[model samples]
Target: MTVNSVLVLGGGFTGLTSAIALALRGVENVTLVERAPAWARVGHGITVQGNALKVFQDIGVVDEILRRGFGADGVTLFHADGSVMMRLQTPKTGGEDLPATLGALRADVHEILVERALELGVKFRLGTQVVSFENHGDSVSVLLSDGTTEFWDLMIAADGIKSSTRPKLGITAERASSGLGIWRGVTNRLPEMTGGIAYPAPGDEGAYKVGYTAISATQCYVFVLCEPQRTPNDLPDWQEMKRLMEPFHGEFDWLRESLNESTYLNFQEIEWIFVEEPWHRGRVIALGEAVHAVPPLIAQGAAQCVEDALLIADYVTREGDLEAHLTEFQERRIPRIKGVVDASLQLAYWECHPGSPDAQPGRVMAQALAELVAAP
Candidate 1:
């Protein structure tokens, strides 16, 4: 591609990572835009697996993340009454020295990536969006919301699952829902809580699951998954959340007591989108959620997106035609992405159809992690 200048769209985890990565690669004149007016920290937590941590380390941000985040060796499965059934040791794929997993407040990660990207000399354009773009085969001309048009040798569409850039490319992808919804909140961390617990929930015809993990020394992220009649904004109140917690005991006791009106909640549908092969057309290419968005069942969404950034950056930095560069990038990514997206969907299915005798969510998780840790 013989890239010089580059334009990165969106400023989420993947977008920011891409921009920072490009800058770290010494790509001068890199510009990143976000539709949002400003960068704000989001509340909630994100579980970053070892693979993503490797990417962070490569980008020079893992130290800050580890300082502010909680590290865990593995997670344990339990009954509602807190009887531990099994402990799954997360693979330290990044390296034996790094923790198998880390849980950080989503906002904290956002801020960390943004700060690092900015410091690396990546110019961020907040409150700006791509109104349109033209792929000249050699370069891409982008029309911005602020009323300016610019061209670059390589254009990365790290926008997101609902990427405006994808539709602009006339690539329509399908997203599947697991018929599951999740309600999440952040609360004070519990004493001696190192990892997390996932308990099989009762009362629903399908098996529902509830889990919580420490995000920091003082806080943790709590989540509930189940088949809901309809999507409602957050739990009605703390009372409702507490009722859901009734089936949980032991480690969940602190969470139940910590539940109060002041607690913030977020509710969302569990969905996955599969963007087809050939993730790029000419100079415009898409990655991350823009191409493959899987359920959080396996917590690989960000990890996979990180892989996209790392791989795309690796290939794009080389000298070649944009077409060849993108093709080679997809060739290396498709197999790995397929394993992650499929395994995530499988685990989601198990959560939704708890009685399915064929379900093997643990096995799926183990296999996927093994593949992720093996190599890029």
Candidate 2:
């Protein structure tokens, strides 16, 4: 099957990378549509593991990303009183050629991808979405939010976890609330990069977990996790910071003092979805969060999205039956994605319900990190 024109829904990390990869390899007429008016993605920070860096290297943007982001060597776990519990060194999975982990402003990463896509002549139709999609035998007829209908040989739905295209194609993807809500903020970076810091829940602050990393030279992304039932609005003052920072007595003193109401804070409950049989229905295929949405415990959400784009681009450029290639693609992706998502969920579950005798504090983390050290 020869693919002429391609339409990608959502202008996210996955969509932009897909468009650029296809265009770089000579996939014609690749246009991406995004509902957002601009490329301002939500969230403050993202941690890209080594595997993600490997993918970025493949797309020819790893150096730019590394130049703008802070690469870390390891992570440190602390007890409530700032006592060192354990320090885990991050292995260089992308190989010794690249840093094992990188901490970046989510907006910076977004800008890099979007700018690269534009440089590669990827067209983006912003501020509109897909209204309807009809899959013909050889091509797909899609109605846009602007009342214009277009045709494409293939349509890639990378429209995030709450994707509009999945249900329209009669795919039953179940998304459930993970019962954990996280509070995130950007604060002044410490004088030194103390690797990454994590404090487990059921602490002095009442079942709250916190993790923070230096995202840039002068700033850090801090996240405090709690039960989903708490209202984030009530946590707008410095008193809220005092409670959240009760665990760390030493290094966090300055970061706590840097908090104010003007500080940008975001709260979101973690939700997950793993769409079984995420493909197969004529000309449309799924990618990114639409197919496998997971918690950030393992920090593979964005990495997996990038991987999805790269793999799809690889298949689209190959000479073969598109459907057969897609079947093989799904086969290669589903198991790895399931393992990563399930491991993340298990760690989150143990955090929320810390009553299990079989669950250890850093055991799952160790195992999951090892599994991720090898490329998927």
Model 2: how far residue 210 lies from native, Å: 0.7
Across 185-278, the per-residue lDDT of candidate 2 in tens digits comes to 8777775754556564352444366777877788888877778755556654445755767666546666767778777777678889998764
What local lDDT does model 2 show for residue 160?
Answer: 88
Q: If candidate 1 were superposed on the true structure by all CA atoms, what would the RMSD be?
A: 1.9
lDDT of 2: 0.80
What's the lDDT of the predicted structure labeled candidate 1?
Answer: 0.82
Give TM per candidate.
0.95, 0.94
Instruction: Name the best candidate (by TM-score).
Output: 1
Clashing pairs in 1: 1-320
- Tens digits of per-residue lDDT, candidate 1, 296-321, equal 87788999898789877778888766
Error of 1 at 72 (Å): 1.0
Clashes of each: 1, 0
Q: What ranges in model 1 sit over 4 Å off?
A: 201-207, 228-237
